[model samples]
Target: MSQAWLRQPERGSVGLLRFAAWLAHHAGRNATRLLLYPITVYYILTSPAGRGASRDYLARVLAEPPGWRQIFRHFFCFAQTILDRVLLLAGRTDGFELAVFDRDGLLERARRGQGCLLLGAHLGSFDMLRLLAVEQAGLKLKILMRPDHNQMITSLLAALNPAVAATLQPIAGPADMLRLRELLAAGYVVGLLADRATPEDRLVTVDFLGGQAALPATPIQLASRLGVPVFTCVGLYLGGRRYEAHFDLLAEQIVIPRSAAMDATRLWVERYAAQLARYLKLAPYNWFNFYLFWQA
Candidate 1:
């Protein structure tokens, strides 16, 4: 909501990224992960804004104020997720362990050719969700996102897996909406991250992690407009190579009357924020929003 995150310049260059990707492919994940320590320390020493944001967030969720070591670990955790994205995109998930908890909901929906919305956050590895759902389970998924923020990384990752890149639906233009509708009608799951709000997004303040935070209302509004099933989903990293993909039905269909659209959207966003807080508490370091969250 601050829009400050959007202003933060991306770190690293195409060469560094290409090298990392090359190292991941050549040296293997375990060996490549040895590089995370120096990378984490470098970022910790250079990025004051991200470090301060981590400390502020930890103070709210953690029992005590976080120390420098904890902040370093936070950066390390983020680094791990990014590294895993490379392996996942490259179809090298044999070493990773994934525990999926969808019950009969999402799988049943997909089996019946009923597409739904998977509302996620920036808390963990979304690429893991894509790996399990699309690759393993054979579900069609379209990720709705704005890839222009980190164009360099986006382009590099797109190069790693062009198939995944093809599934990306940028959040722009009237034509995308029509395409999304067509995809959903054809039983393609559309995923969107609901946590970060841009300047143009409608903001809804909700109680989160002992403080009030502003989240975008657009995802809920979109669900309401589409009148489709909405599911709250997150892929949480549980240390090492373990991950948990959790999915719970948020709504069968969101209906907002024009009379009380504001109130209705607020309620939906509150529910969503509550779900996000629940998962974030489970893996605090998995949260990657490196900005003054509460201020926004």
Candidate 2:
């Protein structure tokens, strides 16, 4: 479904998130498997169009499916979603461990009271990172998200997790840069997705997963403008209802190196792309780019 459909009154962001949490808490592994069986069968039989589209795109990107392995990969992805929702509902804070790479590097920068920007992908349970920031690091996190398409989901999340609702700040475009700047000025950690670029956004073309892809340049631009450090975080699901959140400092200071001349954008874009590929290779199924990404 398009994210726009999520805006339906009954499925507002808050409501949908709460429902997800409820399912996570109530559905055990076996129960969730049984419940998802019908949906799986239906998708397998009725989603030929979508499957074909995905197949075509994969072929163009030189990522063609290896027969049954690809099928199992997609199946595991569907199953992972069920498990992720359950974990979110269970709220078992200590059940998982965060394996932060180059953490001290980021921490050292954070201690300067200048704040930092966290650029992440939609690969894993992004929401879970909020808890780690607040509960583990004692840092206030502000998430920039697109406004929920569904009012019902939004309302439900507001009612069930007020803290999360309070921290979520939705922005539509670069006009919201002032707010982001203000947050950084106040030493608050700001996190945003950096893999998707819309028409109104600045695009940074990079080599990713053996192909050229475009990524949103807002995160890099904002960090450079604000003089804040940038970090890339990747969350990996390690099974048994656990996840490992990895954080790495991407840049100590996003200075346009003198030697790069007019190629500064390309330099930074490649850096980000290389790091992203590394993580995705570690958890291929976790890469959640559902739409055509490497083309157009």
The candidate that wins on TM-score is: 1
Per-residue lDDT tens digits for candidate 1, residues 176-268, read 788878888899889999988887788888778878888888889988888779998888888899999999899999999999998999899
After best superposition, candidate 2 residue 202: deviation in angstroms?
1.5
Root-mean-square deviation of every model: 1.8, 4.3
Candidate 2 residue lDDT tens string, 1-296: 22212222331223324444665568745565555555554554554543543454344433555454464455456455545544553454544555544556656655666688888886666666666633367676788777734345445557656766677778876678889888888888888887766455577677777767777776676677778888887776655556667787888788765576337866786788788778666665566554456643
Listed in order, each prediction's TM-score against the native is: 0.94, 0.79
Q: For candidate 1, what's the RMSD?
A: 1.8
User: In model 1, which regions exceed 4 Å deviation?
Assistant: 12-19
lDDT of each: 0.83, 0.62
Error of 2 at 67 (Å): 2.6
Report lDDT (Cα) of residue 26, candidate 1: 93
Ten-residue segment with the worst summed lDDT in candidate 1?
11-20
Question: Ten-residue segment with the worst summed lDDT in candidate 2?
Answer: 4-13
> Which candidate has the highest lDDT of all?
1
